[model samples]
Target chain A: MFAPVILSIKVAAIATIFAFILGVFFAHLLTSRNIPGTSIWETILILPMVLPPSIVGYLLLKVFGKRGPIGAFLLDTFGIQVVFTWIACVIAACVVALPLMYQGAKAAFQSVDETYCLAARTLGSSEWKIFWTVKFPLARPGIISGIVLTFARAIGEFGATLMLAGNIEGKTQTIPTAIYYAVATGKEDEADVLVLIMTLFSFFMIFILNTWLKKKNYKVS
Target chain B: MGMYFKIKKKLAQFQTDVEYSFDKGVLVIQGESGAGKTTVLNCISGLKTPDEGEIRIDDMVLFNEKTNIPVKNRRIGYLFQDYALFPNMTVEKNILYGIKNKPEYRDRAKRKELLDYAGYMMETFRISHLKKRYPANISGGEKQRVALARAIVTRPRLLLLDEPFSALDARTKETVYEEFFSFKASLGIPTILITHDPRESELFADDRIVMKDGKIM
Candidate 1:
């Protein structure tokens, strides 16, 4: 009972961290430089959110499966298996939740005055220092909300996590998976408890996130 | 011998073909809006690339048909028309921001020297009282002073101003311009100022060029 809740929290936390890092990094790159075919790359990065979660899970399995190139290399060289493990759950959540964080960060960065960046450049600051000191600090509010959104999405992930990590009773079961299993086994009372807990957690996360965003006067589109 | 640019660039509606050589003092480029005064400044500062151009400052070729120097290495101080101060930083931090890239930024004594110099500049500009305030909290004149302090703190070889006083009121403008003139004489660096204010041209311009339709009239 508590095991599934703990696992979900752990998986979401790890996935949100990874997603936050990649999202901010990509957001900075996408906003600062004029890359050719920028819209195409942006669309590709955001595809996971638009697509069905099951499809994302399946894609992950294909790449990280034992017979697949990456999975085969890992299995042979490092004696490590990722699929059907807790790591797979984190990976699946990260894939599906990244777009929200990326979009949020990108919008925040876009609203910053390019002239300030140009001024930093003229002031003799390297791109790296300017990003950390100027760009990132100004965009903090939106990025913080993005992180909250990512965690909420990751914790509630069901279809993708199930497909990649499996619904093992003790090892891989998360809150969503446990709720589904409980209902399937005619344990309606247990399913109701899980559903109530998930709903309350999601509501709290959103409530706090919204209040923080409002306090900062950040309009996250 | 000071700063030179022979350049051509095509814009949406106008094509710029300009050639100028400045030896010293403040050179004012007076023009109406859309006359490409800002564009010329951008080109010289390495913020905008021209299709065909050669830029030489103090006998060193900054850009030509074959070479384009990056903005950081150009050592040109540009004061934007809007006074682009970093919104997240205090006035002191903003002024110190550029000096981090200088060679002396790493040396303890040199860093102290730069900081002391920056403090002196802030005092001179009458912005020492506003040092702890963020850009968003400062008045327009204060913001301009902070921006100016940041630009000159790096000790740039060339100073570029895009309507530096356009945002200030008449009284504040008078005071700021007075400070600017005194500061300009002390530094003795070549400066390119773009403004439509005839009074600025009358009082401060050492050599003036009238720009119309992207060319010197």
Candidate 2:
């Protein structure tokens, strides 16, 4: 039970980091002017968030299975398997958490004044440098919120992780997976304890994030 | 060694046509509201593409009907009417925003020289103590000074100011103009100052162009 909790944290941490990097990139791409097919890409990126987790897991499994296209290619080339592995769990978590990060990051980026970017550009910084130095700093609050939300969503993931990675004890099993396992095995008392822990942890994370944001707002203002 | 450009563009209610050149003096554009003064500055800075025209700065073509270079590549500095300082940056960072991490031309020596110049300007403008402050935490006059510092620190080939004193009080504007003129004399960089205040135009202009109905009169 405790093992699953640790695994859940590790998976969520990895997934959050992955989602944050991609989310910032996608958000910048989405907000940038003159990018072709940006609207279409934005819609596609957010699709996983709205889709049912069970369906997402099922789709992941089909694509990453032993005989599947990507799976077979990996196996033949590098002797690696993805299906039912902890890596699959991370993939599922990242997919589920991506939209939250993207949305928050996009909002944050949009709130900055265009003049700041123009100023940096005229000062001779390249577009990439301006993004890192100016845009990213101004958008830090939103990015932080997105990361927290991604971590929460990744830790609470169950349906997709189970279908894609399988709830292997001490390996692929996370907090939500452990809860499912405990319940299915009629360990009602253990399931209750895990459920309480998850709830408390989620509440604490949200509280901390909100408090930190409020303090930051006060400091800036 | 400044440059010249002629711009013509069709807007919703006006057709902008202006021909101007900046040498080594303060070139002021003066007119009332809706007179297309800001548009002229915008066109020169490559913020707005003209329908038909060319902008050349220091023998480098910024835009022509056949080709358009983006604002990022243009070596032009602009000061917005509202100062437009990045709210997220401290005064020091804001001043350095345009001059950080260039080649030997923009190294620590040049940066520190500009910073010292900026610090002197700040003291002259009464914002010397707000170096660690953000825009939101500073007064309007301070914000304007910081904006000016940010624009000038890069040593742009052309400096465009859009009604820089419109947001400040009369006393503040007087102090700002005094500091600004001293800084201008030191750099000797050709500047285009946009203003609706005829008094301001008379006070600072070495050459004046009046815009009415989008055409320079």
Candidate 3:
């Protein structure tokens, strides 16, 4: 009864952690440097958010499929498989959730006063120190909200997870996949229960996010 | 012991071409909005790169075509037009921040000495009472003093002020100027101040460079 729910929570938590790390690093990179073709890079990072989930799933499968380059390398090198597994579910969730994390962090970093960074530099602080002490703290509220959004997106992922990891019962069946299965099989009672749980979970996360942002005097316009 | 730079940088509207050197006292760069006064300070502090130039503070080469020292290693203290106080830190923490990451701090005795120095700076700036207060709660003049304290706490080789008194009122400006004069007298380092206000210029400037359309006159 609770296997899918527990699996969804685990996948979302791990995916959110991965997204947060990549998102913060990429956000800092994109904003701090005068890299040529920055806008194109930003657009590429953002593509998964707008692309069809099935397309994202298809791309993931291609990269991680047993016959693909990366997949074949892993198999030959380490005797590991990635496709159609719980790991693939996590990968799918990370891809879909990453854009949210990236966009949020980028905006947060951009909003920080450039002068503070310059001031820190002139005060004999290394670039690494300035980022950890000055930039990160000032941008914390926005970054936290980004993390929450990523977790929400991760747990709610469906189409991509179904394509990549499949709807294997007890193995990779997340909340969304389980709900779909219940509805398609005409198990209306089971579907209703799962829907209630998912809705309540999402509402709780959003509620926490709103409260935190408000406490930090951040108003969403 | 002096600072020298001959820099040329092309802006959207004009090209900056200037050559100057300053020994020990305050040198004021007086100019209008588009005269590239701030850009000069940015170049000296290693915050911005020039198309062609060599910057030397005393015997150290801060910037040249072949070599550019990173901003942190340049050891310049800069007070921005906006103060740029770390909004997340308390006044005391902000003042101490400049020295906290210094290599000297790795030594236990040196760390204690720096902390003592920070306390002295807080007392000197009259921010001892506001030690726990965040920048958002401090007044404009108090913010400036705190910023000044933070800048000079590192014992920098040079000091750069970009209209440091622009935000203060007449009364606050007078008090802040007095505080700055006392601070400057003690440091004995060269100062480059960019300000359009003639009164501010008259108060602290030992020498004045007039800039018009990015050219020194």
How much lDDT does each candidate structure score? Answer: 0.88, 0.83, 0.90
True contacts kept of 3: 0.73
CAPRI quality band, candidate 1: medium
Top TM-score prediction, candidate number: 3
**TM-score of predicted structure 3, chain A:** 0.96
Model 2 achieves a DockQ score of 0.53
Residues forming the 10-long window of minimal summed lDDT in candidate 3 chain A: A212-221
Alpha-carbon runs more than 4 Å astray in model 1:
A214-221
Docking class of 2: medium
DockQ of 3: 0.55
TM-score of each: 0.93, 0.90, 0.95
Candidate 1: share of reference interface contacts reproduced = 0.68
Report the C-alpha lDDT of model 3 over A160-194, residue by residue, as the tens digit.
99988999999999999999999999999999999
Q: What's the best-to-worst order under DockQ? A: 3, 2, 1
* Higher-DockQ candidate of 1 and 2: 2
Error of 1 at A65 (Å): 2.3
Order of candidate numbers by TM-score, starting with the best = 3, 1, 2
